[model samples]
Structure formats: structure tokens, C-alpha cells
Target: MAEIETLQELYVDELKDLWSANDQMAKALKKILGQATNGKLKDMLQASQDGIAKHTDVLKALIEGQDEKLKKEHCKGMEGLVAEALKHTVEEAPKTGPVLDAAIIAQYQRMTHYGITGFGTVAAFAKALKLDDDATKLEAAVADMHKGDDLMSELAESAVNVEAVKG
Candidate 1:
């Protein structure tokens, strides 16, 4: 981690954290996708992974622009989220079927919500620093996260939760 003194430094730190979070989520989603029994859920997770990769690239560029090495500051919050997700979706979740799908969805949303907050804060930090371009890029990331959340809600209501209850 670089020495962070000003709000701009804080912004870069947050950006680094988000970079780590994106990487962690991308890896977690792959494991979760394998565990998921629902085809729609699998597709959604795949799409999210693609988005995460793109976002990671953006974060890397920003970090490098700060005269710092392109590296991630371990996001402890994301680490915990990933651990909890593995517990639910891999270790203790049902072996298969709608019940497991429900668990995956639940865990996935937890991660997505985390991204939403992190990205939103980064965008706000960029705006506060009067970096409009960075802010716009970050806000776009936030929008993508919200879209994922919305899809999860739709899947839960229309299929996943209903099927899960029948278990």
C-alpha cells in the first residue's frame, strides 16, 4: 500500500480495495457457477465474471496512474464475503438442485451488494476530487452491479426462491 495522506490518496486506496474485491468475486463466481444447478443462474454468473474482468482492467490503469505499482490492497471485507460464500455454496450447501441454487443466489447477492457500495464510494471519491472522467467510469461500474442485483431479484422471485422452498 502506498502512503495515503489526502482525499485523493484515500480514493486510490479505495480503488485498490475494489480491484481486489473484483478479483476475488471473479474467482468465487467460477466456483459458485459450478455449484449452481440452475441454468439461468449459471449464465448470470458468467456474465458477471466478464464484467468483473473488464472492471479490474480499469482499476489497474487507475492504480498505475497514481505512480504506484498496479497492485491490489487486500479488501478484508471481500475476503470475509468470499469465505462466507464458500461456506454456504461449497462446503455446507446442498449437493445439488434448487436449494443449492438458492444458496448461491443469496451468497452472490451478498458479494454484489458489497461491490455496489465499494464502487459507489469510489465514484463519490473521484467526483469529490473533481476527476469527472474517473467518476464516470466508476459510476458505470456501479450501474453494472445494480443490474446484477436486479437480475438476482428477478430470478429469486420468478424461480429460485419458489423452487428452493419446495425443498
Candidate 2:
């Protein structure tokens, strides 16, 4: 028979997985920013980098608060996503304006979706464990990032650079 998993076990495992994912995304985004030629794209990357740092801090506190040691399990999901983003970036490099912008938007959205999923999962786990304060804080942070992701999508769809790519 399969062993049943406790809530604490689930939370700790998921948190470690998420932390690793965030670190991977952070590195990938920084690399993209370094290669980005568009001022607006660079700004977005910088904002995202800051957000990733904040998320890392929160994850660390949550793990430590549970008396768990800070550690990361390899997050294969995030590794795959980051690899794909790097491939796309390399495939479209130096193709500035709309083409480059479209690629950036696509890659950014993928990373954002990954973050949203991770944060939401953590928040739900916190709630299930009756960790009310932690749940609230995690949910708030997730909500803010969700909004940012939506805004980035909107900007990509309507921005001149994206439009230029389609022209």
C-alpha cells in the first residue's frame, strides 16, 4: 500500500520544488535582460528580477518558519521551461522591435504562468494547514504577480513592438 502524506510533508516538498524553480527562472530572466536591446523590455525584465528576489525571500521565511532547513529539490518542470525560454531567446536574438518583443512576451508569459501556479499551490497548502497568516501573505503576493502578468500580456498585445512584428 502507498503511504499517506501529511500536510507538512506536502508543504515542505512543494516549497523546496518551488524555490528551485524560482531560482532557475531568475537566472534565465537575467540572461534575457542582458541580451535585450529594447528599453521597455529591459525595464520589464528588471521588474521581474526584483519580484523573483522578493518571492525567494518569502519562500525562505515560510520554510524556516516551519522549522525546515533551507534546501531545494530539483524542479524539473521549471528546468524545462527555462530551457525552452533560452532556446527561444537565442533563436530570436538581435531581431529587435516587434519580432524580438513578441518573443520576449511569449517567454515572459510562460515564466509568469509558472510562478502563478507555484504561488497559488503554496497558498493553498498554507490554508489547508491552517496557517492563516502565511496563507494570506502568500495569496497577496500571488495576486500581485498575477496582475503583473496580465498587464504584461496586455502590453504585449497592444504595444507597437508586437504590432510591428505582425506587420
lDDT of 1 at 23: 90
lDDT of 2 by residue, 26-71 (tens): 9998787766655777787899888888988888888899998888
lDDT of 2 at 7: 79
Q: 109-143 in candidate 1: lDDT tens per residue?
A: 99999999988998899899888888898899889
Give model 2's TM-score versus the native structure. 0.90
Identify the runs in model 1 with alpha carbons over 4 angstroms from their true place: none
- Candidate 2 colliding pairs: 98-161
The local distance difference test score of model 2 is 0.81
Q: Tell me the TM-score of each prediction against the true structure.
A: 0.95, 0.90
The candidate 2 region of ten consecutive residues with least summed lDDT is 90-99
